[model samples]
Target: MALYNAAALIPSGLLSVVFSLASIFNALNARVFFGEKIAVRVVLAGLLGVSGLILLLWDSLTVSFDPDTVRGIGWALLGTMIFSWGNIASRRNSATRTAPIIANAWGMGIGAGVLLVLALATRQPLVVPTDPTYLAALLYLAVFASVIGFTTYLMLVSQIGSAQAGYATVVFPVVALVISTFFEGYAWTATAVIGIALTLLGDAVMFGRFGRKRAGKILKLT
Candidate 1:
């Protein structure tokens, strides 16, 4: 999470696009670390989702690059790798009977301690925000994103294998885009439409929403 926040300092939309690769890393880690057998459909869905992400951000990524942009992308990739490891850890902990809420509380506490130490060592100011908006945002992040969101995701990791659960990262961008359209005045382009369609299709495929008969036919062909 620290790595992810660090990467957000980068000014390039490409950083956001690259970060979506965490889903791929998560799937791979589930196989390597947990010995989870990845289904063909899952791989296909991941590929489609990644392709959609590329299309979704292709325009933003075409901007002229700088050394800082390159470095930022590297940080984003590194963060994504670490995030995948976190997913694996969550899955492992859940397997060992650690409740999601308990695991998240401990994990968040330890992470906060590490960040506090880092801030102190760096001599960063630890002043609290006075702005009501800032405080509200922080509260929302703490409650919705950190608590509810993570708990649900960890629960999903326990119910489904990590590979399938990792698709959440891929789906997040689509939601962000919708929010951007309304709140940030983002324009919907042809490429974005196609990307959204592909992303939805990938999600459907991942969840076996294509129907059992269709899945069986595809399986037989493969």
Candidate 2:
């Protein structure tokens, strides 16, 4: 709902930038909910990430104070906050021995049901997508984005913390841009190159120590 409204009222790139708030929201949620310490590296990495994302999509960014735009920002920020809370929930689930696979399966199933109900209630006609590209994208998002992505992210949250695992959301755009470069001939600007670099540096800083700590835990468990 939030993303749909945002897409209607704002550019996709702008919507994505709004969504990037998930990183900071996750860190704050962790600190509040789980009493996790907010590290300086996490803060620095978030700064770099927001800056890099803005630069990378600077061409797509926009500013407006229209009512619809305001509403879109509100909706997008709501989505980000919900997503951040979900990360903490996933962490809690993992801590409680709920396997990621199980959690993701139930989540998707329930979410699908809810969407169907909403569609019916709202009198939205069900339409099958006939476009091949649309079908392919649907398949990719359902399988890779939802199932595999959510499962792996849940595992990461378990290993590290919800805060660090949330960087996945922050770094996702660079992956899309990389694919665009290869397949869609995305043009690179100086800002883009620097932006990608900063985003990566942020992820490395955010994950470096926690990654090693997770490895050590794995060794000990083994």
Expressed as tens digits, the lDDT of each residue in 47-152 for candidate 1 is 7887887788767666546776666767788888887898899988987999999999999999899989999999999999899999999999999999999999
Residue 64 displacement (Å), model 2: 2.8
TM-score of each: 0.87, 0.88
**Runs in model 2 with CA error above 4 Å?**
209-222
The C-alpha lDDT values of all candidates are: 0.79, 0.83
> What does the lDDT come to for candidate 1?
0.79
Candidate 1, residue 51: Cα displacement in angstroms equals 1.4
Model 1 residue-pair collision total = 0
lDDT tens digits by residue: candidate 2, 1-222: 667878898888888788876778888999999898666667677877878888998998867779988888888998888888888889889889999999888888888999999999999999998999999999999989889988988888889787777777777888899999999999999998998888887877677876445445655675
